[model samples]
Target: MSFNNLMIYRHPCIVKYVSSWQKNCKFYLAVEEVTPLSHVLPLLNTLQICVGLHSILKALHFLHEKASVSHNNICISSIYVTRDGSWKLGGMEYLCRYEDLSSDFLNKSRMNRYFKAVDSNEEKVFVNPTARRDFIDVYAFGVLVYEVFKSRESFDEVPNLDVFCDYCRNELQHTDPSQRPILSSILKHDFFNHEFINIHSFLIELPLKSDEEKMLFFRSLVGRLKMFNEEVVASQLGNLLLSRMVLLNGVAQETIVPFLLTPKSDEQEQTDQLFSEDTFKKYISPKLLEIISVRDAQIRLLLLNNFSNFMYMFTKEELQMYFLPELLVGIKDTNDHLVSVTLRTLADLVPVLGAATVIGGKRAKLFNDGRPMAHSNKNLPKEGTPQENEHPVVRDQILNNSISSIIDSHNLILPERSRPDGEEVETSTEEIEQSVDEDLENWDDWDLNENHSILINRLGIADIIEDSNDIAENHSNEGIKSIVNTKGDLARSKKTIADIEELDIKSQVQNNENDSFDFFHDMEPVINSSSKFLINEDNKCDVSLGIDKEVSSKLALNVNDINEEGWGDGDWD
Candidate 1:
């Protein structure tokens, strides 16, 4: 009968009954674990006692008035404390209905055990057990109060002793069974009245309220939740709030989350905060992880917006393994605002996820014609290998080729590929000549070799060079008359064979006309040690003639000395 009563009843102050069955001819009962009240009695202060006693009275009222069932076994040992510090009524072995209470049942089971032993003088006349059956439990509650107070030395030891004594004397301990107060009247006493107790009652009835009522209640409850400084109380409160997160509106949620997570306003009162650090780690953090795993955009966005308030509650490993992956889901969402917010959240996580994981990840390769090619070291010169200096002839040839290409590029008409059709481009000869001459002026910085065969071929310089030679010939004819006046002075001046060899020699040709032109006539005549080359009236040599001093004294060399040197080797050939 007791097991049936426990299994049938459901109340916050009652021990939560899980399931019961009989297997192998044995009875099994499962219930939520709770601590015996006697074990933690030493730890309770005045406030905790008020909170606990209120819970027990509510349980008695539930059994007596609502169910018309009498517990018949209310004692120190029957009361238990849950993890959240709320007291519960358990030991229901003597449970019976009010209609079933008779003298035989009271004498056999309830009237003898778990309370103070009755004295022989106190055993007076037996009264009608059914007339005042509820008074029996009320009288037992008076005895419970006497026993609890007797354990303390003075009123100062338990500050609310005067209140409990007044209630016991005024109602529960009345000699006439008719005069004793009922469980409902006993519950209204000042001993069970407190702010925390009222909050506990409100929470117990919260689920039955409408959404608008709950919203108003939660909004007002935020400021008062801080009064519960005990870890057990705060943890239970947090559990209640989390369980009802789906029911809460946005305004209520926003109002309560900061109170649960943010630190206390006063630093000195940190230890007295309702949601202490330990409570968060043990309960709130794991609950938050489960909450974030849900993909509802509203919940996700709310957590993200207020992430800074509670982010410290999670460890690095927890964020990395769980929270980080969940947060990244927002980035892939189709909503532009969600994606934008997710990007900002990821930026804040850079320190934890590292630069390479969050914002530093690799991007796709770019395909562009203008992209520069990567550098290569394949053509770099090797160490210890003798570096050959560039020969002036080859260097000059390369330079002239480059300059000639530039001039050609600037003067050439549009190619057929660039035009709409393969049509020939018409350009004036003067335009081509003018462009080449402008480019040649830029090369005056370097003392280049007079021979420009490579440059002439690349630039198509046949026409331009021919024109230049014609101009040079005209200038030379006029210069000869002036040179005749200085010829007498030049006849006495001696020169070496090297001076003649150093003179510049230039050749020119006309395009499409195959006519060769030379600048020999324009050059000044150079004399050697041999007097045969002197300009005189009797020996009037052609000013455009060539001279070769093949056997001069300075040019003569011994064949033996040449052979003695390595030049005689066949490798030189």
Candidate 2:
């Protein structure tokens, strides 16, 4: 059978089954062609190997706990590596048994006979078969891990697994499985200690190793484990990898050792153990401080992304005091995407830190530094003085818009105070009032008045005379001056008369305020009386503000339309 057919026929990790069905055969024979370990081992890294080993061990533990099935045939060759670098136990021919089965039976029949025997009597007489077998699998897995670490060399070629197995068999021959050292003990045994030669030196040198070496090592370890049983492979791999990483990083040993060695669990000692100056300098400080110095936006983003995960292994105070400055610098990035992500991270972290001090500090610095917003009026000459004639209104509006955009983009809503302890704390309402007052203090700084005036003029408000009487009064004064100077002309006189007539019309309209009010009140009746009336009224106006006569009449009719729809009768003010 092909690999595809095998995948379809059996478990995912196993190879294709190559056998034929035949009647009158004493027993069935199934042969599986597996991928060689040489082809698989080099693909895994230290981390991947560790994860695979961890998972395998856990799976074994689970099998023992739930199914009570011990897979006694545990070896590197018995484990198959999946294309995705996962390990699975296979090749069960070597499984051990307490009962001797007849040679005429197939491997399955022998397994069944062994399982029956173990289930019947051995479980009660000796340790539970499953648990005992799981440990055996674990032991085998450790050997596989050792094999991978030694680059697939035989146990005798590196450290003899036979010797270790013999030692285990001799020392842990008790009937009670509890008397045996578990997989962890096996891992930390003196035999393994010989394997970890110069552990302290190796760890200390890991940081200095090339990234390529780290990547290759990790890949090879994982790939090798996948060629074996993935579960056992992953568990052993994970533990060893984590152990190496901790040792290499010096984080756990440095932070955990001295305190654990000490007798008293003093508060100060505990605090010191949890946080230290060297801890900050080693992990948090360098990554954060390096962000500012690194010019690449992509690199900065990657750093920021990793910073969160790194900080997860530390406390809140460590993050804030050490890493926050680097995070803040990213927020000021010219790249919109970088700035957006940085701000998002800060927004998330604010609640975690529980204090506004860091954010507040950044906000203050941002405002003080005269950043992009300071150069908002790009139209103005860069070298020009304040008096050299830039429109203040335009400048002010731009500045306000920029500042508002920055603040809004960050979603920096101020915290509301209910008092954390539920006490009725007396805060000065005056401070709140003062904050509101400060909102417009920078209005003149950005030049918004000129912009507002330009908008008003563009809207034709300049042409709309405020009062006709005022126009009339100015025209009369001009005429009087012209006459007094003996410069009065026919054109001037005619212009003055026209101005007076327009003023008279305006004055009449202005003086009839009560009539206008009455007209508004009675508009519906007038409009309903005739369409001619509506058209005649509309034609009198120079410009329509888009209000149709019918709509206007309806609005007039419902002037006190508080009960109409959304308008409530409650005091709005």
Best TM-score among the predictions, by candidate number:
1
Per-model TM-score on C-alpha atoms: 0.53, 0.23
- Residue 90 CA displacement from its true place in model 1, Å: 1.1
Task: List candidate 1 stretches off by more than 4 Å.
Answer: 23-25, 110-112, 117-130, 145-161, 208-219, 227-236, 241-251, 263-276, 282-308, 316-573
- Tell me how many residue pairs clash in candidate 2: 39
Query: In model 2, which runs have C-alpha deviations exceeding 4 angstroms?
Result: 1-38, 42-59, 65-68, 77-188, 191-573
Model 2 accuracy (lDDT, Cα) = 0.40
Clash-forming residue pairs, model 1: none
Superposed Cα RMSD, model 1? 18.3
Go through the candidates in order and give each one's C-alpha lDDT: 0.57, 0.40
